[model samples]
Target chain A: MKPPLWQSIGFYILVGVIVLQALFPFYYAILTSLEDGQALFEVNYLPRALNLANYQAMLSGGVFGKQILNSVFVATVVVILSLFLAVTAAYALSRIRFRGRGLLLLTVLSVSMFPQIAVLSGLFEVIRYFGLFNSLWSLVFSYMIFTLPFTVWVLTTFMRNLPIEIEEAAIMDGASSFTIIRRVFLPLMWPAMVTTGLLAFIHAWNEFLFALTFLSTDSQRTVPVAIALISGRSEFEIPWGNIMAASVIVTLPLVALVLVFQRKIVSGLTAGAVKG
Target chain B: MSKTVQKSRLSRSRTRSAWLFLAPMLLTLAIVAAWPLGRTIWFSFTDASLDLMGEARFVGFRNYLEYVAWGDGEGQYYGLLADARWWRSVWNTILFAVVSVSFETVFGLIIALVLNQQFRGRGLVRAAVLIPWAIPTIVSAKMWAWMLHDQFGIINDMLQTIGLIAEPIAWTASPDTAMVAVLMVDIWKTTPFMALLILAGLQMVPGDIYEAAKLDGVPPWRVFRKITLPLIMPAVLVAVVFRALDALRVFDIVYVLTPNTDATRTMSVFARENLFDYDKFAYGSAASTLLFLVIALITITFIMATRMDLEGKRS
Candidate 1:
């Protein structure tokens, strides 16, 4: 049953290609971030020097540090808010057999597919009306349109698979719906909640258009927008080193999270897509 | 009779709680999604300027199409439908979506098949494949932009060293290669997602079937074509459709990698330009409305074509 030597070699070579293609860009980014001045201009395949000057410059700048914090706050609040709303809504959608349930689920799915630009003009007006144009709340508010639907869909799918026996027992014991959800379902739903929350956090963190459109100030911008707007005085002086450093700093945390919760992330993604 | 009454009471309470639980979510959707979408569609018909949105007068379809008559039957059309740039963006959007999604699916299938094999360090390989997907889109765009830099980029340097070309090409700046650069970056980033989705489907195909096929001396290529491909088609189709819809709305990559270039301006970018930069808010609204309609039409056709079991009847 063993494969031929040539075939095995070919397979291994393909695997090598896949691995190299996947990891090289990020690796090069890290390499570029460590190089400065003349070294950056000349492309060296290997790391010649261990330098923290770019990282030092990036962190020493007050605005980049603040932008990172801005990104963290926005993504964190978005995750927490969307999870709370989605859990309750998922309970209703999945556990209760109500009229229009199918239609309602379809609505949620379609909303997730909405082009964000479609809502930009009106949402811009809404933000202005609420006096939230320059604030992080604008992002928090607008981000719900994208985050809520998937969270609700994935959680509903997850919630529906929970055993009914426990809920039935609780119901027979004269426990309220909220009480059963609190006592019986909450513990069981943690893995799903974590997965959906992480996805939501990433979506909010990486959101660019809305963040770029709504927040005009440097200090209020998220990391994605800030990294995008990172520039020197002129086109010729575009700061590639600082830009690469900022890119690496923001991406490392996400990479770690994906690697750590690798299995959960896969299951969460499949449950959201393949199940539908 | 007492038992029946209790059951009815329980059902009633459940429905009530369902409504109560859904209330907050519905309200948020209304505020964030439904209301704004309605306004956007409405704005598409008005002469709404960014600065004079309040005093905007209703102008029916003028932003979409307006034909001004000139003497001797000579005339010119003005508006989104008549604008060559708008149509160009539409073409660009469709082309980008088709090209990116197709490549991603193919590459994704290849990667998924490779990863499906029993090998050492499979977890590490899978994680490595996921690195591109895990990176933020903007960051990846920046990374690729740096690498694809005309003069100082390593991509050009390596290509030259490898004797691929005579000179380093300006990837993001040149019109001929801008879209190619965008697609390269997009395929690199999204192929992992497609692969993961297909990998999920691959895992569902029972191993015993493959074993049985092997016992029958079925060739690996035939087994893949006849069994594996047929089995994973559903997952692959769903993933392709998702990726296509996503690609149609591609903004961040094109916007970051090649800005202000007609070669890569997508519908989302074009709409945003008019909305803010061009001071043609209503015109932008019309463009966005068209984009929505295109996506909506595709989504509806897909749902109907697949006859998706929205009620979970299959489950």
Candidate 2:
């Protein structure tokens, strides 16, 4: 039997509220980014004006442009390194029968749970020892604390689900484990790769604590830190308009990825959680 | 050569290759994670300053004792324990985790239930819900801060216009409402995550079970309570554990939106302040170590309780 009219209406209302809650702040950010100086402080819910001054001001001067580039480069490098390491390790963990494999996987998971503050002091010493303080490499190295474990876990789950016959056939042809992984399994793993890579990229991109702690120079900071430390000329004023604009600029790419790869991302997320 | 000899050689080569494949990742993890974690524990016992030139000396458990002890009849506590702000932060962190995770789980269940229905534009709705999760935490914090601004924030304006309040309230500034404000932003940001995870669990409940329940004229709520909930409990537990761990260490949202205010300082913000801002390096290390231990204890307990397989197989 059909549900009553009020129940249907309630369901739709709930859906609408969820949509609004998810999108309103972001929608408002875009609107705020578009408003000029005087209009910036207005409490209007809708877009009041079309202005590019904040965006222009943010991009033109300061290290905002370089910071964006640094964020991109850092996240990209982390993804590549994480995926490479995760792939080889995932192959070994899933395919090879080995002792202590269970313990190894648990150790990897535990590493991901280490709070950045827990490692902050020691990592500071490590960075300084490597002469990477206040540099882009510091963020890259430290982010592995999070990104690597997640990638390995998700990729191992994906690898285990592949058919055994394929690997058996490859082995029958005298394919080494590496050769089988490269020629046989890698072809079937692109979707998993994309999902894992995108998640890693987002994690590295959104990471704030380490970025805040590791990089001190204005130009070397990533997007999150740069936006957090974005300020007005004097000590008294904070340039909210410029900060919103920078926030929008940094967030847009990730939003695009989420929208385009929504299905894969959901699967990737569930694969990581439900399986664990 | 005998067949067993060849088999052993092949198996040995596979083991060697497995180690080879794992070497780089393990080594990277060692240098980046293990070494620093060990050093952090060591530093917790020493008075190592953030300043590179400061003299380092072993202080034993003085730092840890100060973190948990009261002072000698002087109307004060010693160490981080003595600092009212530190206790406030610890309380705030626990409060934030319990309240925010509870909200996320409830709202997420609602959204997941709604999305689990057969509907048009379900895919689009799923993608739209991810927007909040997709936004960077700093950006989300900034966005909410602007919208929650007492003077010109849309939230205050809308609340007043709707006759919800008589006057504007300073959300992040005041001790009374600061934690509430942080919870609102966190729930908004993470509810989608909770929903998606629950939705995944919901999808795993086979349709035939629902059909069977319908055939027996079982009420929807009954079906949900008896069938859906039990089936989804594992996923829910996993989601809760992950979210709790994340929320317990929350630093960016509180730091960006409210700064150093005691109203919203978390353990992380508290510890980071000691480490970097106050130069109480050993003290901060102890605090950090304590935080790690709390989280590690929770994680270990959860793993052992659930008997979860790392292989992700259904066993």
Q: Against the true structure, whose lDDT is highest?
A: 1
lDDT of 1 at A68: 93
Per-residue accuracy of model 2 over B9-46 as CA lDDT, tens digit each: 88898899999999999999998999988888888888
| Model 1 C-alpha lDDT per residue in residues B22-48, reported as the tens digit of each score | 999989988999998988999999999
Off by over 4 Å in 1: none
lDDT of 1 by residue, A80-186 (tens): 99998999999999998989999999998899989999999999999999999989999999999999999999998888887778698898899988887889999
Candidate number of the best TM-score = 1
List the candidates' TM-scores in order.
0.99, 0.96
Question: Chain B, TM-score, each prediction?
Answer: 0.98, 0.94
Q: Give the TM-score of candidate 2.
A: 0.96
Candidate 1 residue pairs in clash (backbone atoms < 3 Å) = none
Instruction: Report every candidate's CA lDDT.
Output: 0.93, 0.89
DockQ of each: 0.86, 0.80
* Candidate 1 to truth, TM: 0.99
Positional deviation of A173 in candidate 1, in angstroms? 2.0
